[model samples]
Target: MTDIKTPKTWRSPAVDIYETEAGLTLIAELPGVERDALDLAFDRGTLTLEGRSDDIGYQRRFRIPEHLDAEEIAAELKDGLLTVTLPRAAGARARKIEVTVH
Candidate 1:
């Protein structure tokens, strides 16, 4: 019998999303992925992340909210963990209103 090789499959990395008054934050666990191999992009209202290392790779996508600023998005990778921060637009941020007692 001849040996047959199967194609490798790519799996979505584990991710955690949090929303705060300032903006949204996404944390993904990508073990074995190198810092230079990661890619981040925001277009229209969609956010995507992809990276690869050896036989393991990660891919994930999210729909960004209208309040968030796509141009100001930033990302950092450390200790196999990727952290992406999306800041809220100037007008979208929450403002505290002072109360006056007469």
Candidate 2:
């Protein structure tokens, strides 16, 4: 009798998203993936990431917040990790206003 207790494989890529006062950050783990193999696209309010590593391929899509500035999207790949930064839109940036004393 063979013991079949191995964990099931997952088909989706591993990713993490974080939101801060200044912007939103996305991190993805892509082992064996070359920098040139990665592809990123943003349309409307959606951000998509697709890539292939070794024999594995991955695709992920995220719904970006309206407060985020899609024009300032930036990405970096280092140590098998991809980091993307999306700055908040102009209206989302924090501001201070003074009230006139009566």
Every candidate's CA RMSD: 6.3, 8.4
Instruction: Predict model 2's lDDT versus the native.
Output: 0.81
Candidate 1: 10-residue stretch with minimal lDDT: 1-10
Q: Give lDDT tens digits, candidate 1, residues 1-102.
A: 112222166889999989898898899999877767777888779998888776666788898989888889999999999999999999998899999999
List the candidate 1 regions with Cα displacement exceeding 4 Å: 1-7, 99-102
Cα lDDT for residue 68, candidate 2 = 88
- What would the per-residue lDDT of candidate 2 be over residues 22-101, giving only the tens digit for each residue? 89899999776677777789998899887776456767899998888889999998998999999999898988998999
Whose TM-score is greatest here? 1
Q: How many Å off is the CA of 16 in candidate 1?
A: 0.6
Residues forming the 10-long window of minimal summed lDDT in candidate 2: 1-10
